[model samples]
Target: MNVRFEKLYEETKAAVMRYVSAHCYSITDIDDLFQDTYLAVYKSMQSLTEPIQSSEAYVIGVAKKVLARHYSAVRRLRAQIDVSLDRRSGRGLAEETADSVDVEKLAGDRELLDEIFELVTVMPVTVQRAFYMHYVLEMSFAEVGNELDLSEAAVRQRVARALTEIRRLYKRREQL
Candidate 1:
């Protein structure tokens, strides 16, 4: 590894481990996320044009993407499991199931939370990083701005835009 990447790893490895551990339920999952996060950083490190103001924040951003992709794949796998179980039981419970047994009930409002995450994922990378740092990780806007090389006001705007998009997505999904 180059000196810069080595320095980044040494500086941010603990924070990355903590991030993965906090976000995942299992040790295996944490390991997987950690590996994936480092891989992402390694691949993208070359493309970073400017000096990194906050290596911790940048690595955390990569970790968040790894987690999101992991969760999305897990959700798909769970849906497949549900389908397989229903088929194996050889009983059609679809019609008799209560209307309340949708994604909301299964996840206790987590469906909406996942929707917000999905919306955030589609945002520009910088904006997504700012929003995640400020909201999900509870970093101050000033901290996020410093990390992302943006003004605090710019971070605030990114967060506001992300929120607006999430609200719009929620409303549109509700209508459907």
Candidate 2:
């Protein structure tokens, strides 16, 4: 360590530590942030062009940058985690619409289930297979395509067409 940096550290370490401690919530985070602050200060000290007039303020500025970076990274990671969870939970547009209907409430109605099956059975064989593979078996479009030797787009088209037809049939039955 440079003699100048050692002197600067001795002078401003306490203030930097207090700043980091007050901003950070966890002890581990505090320790990490404190280390990062000092490491940044050390690097800045190495590239000295002019003598820093106020070591305390300079150290505090470094700590603030470290804190900002830490918070930004945490926010980015949380957003990525939320996106992963939504994908895993099957919360895409079609799935969200399906979820709006209370399937559990209708589960005991055998006649309704039969009518749904009849509507599904009316779909073309490929459409029926696509719908079953994608929704019933929880397979992705790519997986369904691989299994049936169809393109993913073709599989998606089949499933979407089936859903639209089924929704129409369901509404007609409800009108009756």
Candidate 3:
């Protein structure tokens, strides 16, 4: 700590703390942010091309930058977490649609399960792969997409369509 720079830091530290406290909503982040702001200020202070007129004002600028970076990172992490959750939950689209179909019937009737499996085998190749990977193998839509070289949306659509087709076929059989 240069004696001149140390003097300036002492003068501005309180004002910088207040500025950081004012901008931040979370108490847990405040101390860490306060530390980061001063670390930046110290680095800037080291590169003294010319003396700053108002050291307090200069430190406040550094604190603002730190706060901006913190919030930007927090936003990015939040978005990634949201996207991950949406993708996983979206994988259940077929299951939700299948819920409309009577799975309990298949559970009690082995012959009906066999018939449904046959119907699934005769479905379009894309639909069959999507349905089998997702339902039979219990794979997530994203995993099915990777296995079938399709997008997650495409995989979800195929599985859903397969379920719809099976329902139609099962109803036709019931009528007969």
Candidate 4:
């Protein structure tokens, strides 16, 4: 191990472990996150150009990225499962249309998609991510949970809130 990295690990390991533990959903995830955090931090430290005020904070930021990437992969896996199940069940586009508004029309309208994009941009970041994951990425609420590290219910609520806001905005715009 590099001397500086060894020193950093000695200084920050306990606090980092606490953070990873608090954020992790599983014991396996805890180990993976911790190791990935240090590896990222080590690479970052090697290439660092400017000074960071806190080593622990920087390492924690890298940990956050690792967690995000991990969750992204999980979401992809969930989406794949969702797709396979849909295929096996013979659920087609019309079936999906019955559950929600047909995004197909909006998807075909570049102008409408652009307008909705702008509307979503102003919403809270959490809602935006959930909305994008569920609608744009074509993930179910359960898969959206993987992206946000939230419960399926929680991601559903976020997307619902975004939809409510978009409906309100569209109604108001129509009266103009």
Best by TM-score: 1
lDDT of model 3 at residue 55? 87
Per-residue lDDT tens digits of candidate 2, residues 44-152? 8888799899989999999999989876876547634222232223213232224245556567868767756655555555665666556655678997787667899
**Model 4 CA deviation exceeding 4 Å by range:** 73-176
lDDT per residue as tens, model 4, 20-92? 6546544335678889999888888888778657878877888888878877976647634221232223212
lDDT by residue for model 3 (1-176), tens:
57877898789876665555445534335578889987887887778788889888888888888888888976647634222333223233332233355556556766667666656555555676566556645678997687667899988888777777666545544444
TM-score of model 4 relative to the true fold?
0.42
Cα-based lDDT for every prediction: 0.68, 0.66, 0.65, 0.64
On the 0 to 100 scale, the lDDT of residue 117 in model 2 is 65
| Count of clashing residue pairs in every prediction | 0, 0, 0, 0
Superior by lDDT: candidate 3 or candidate 4: 3
Candidate no. 1 TM-score: 0.43
Q: Write out the backbone clash pairs for model 1.
A: none
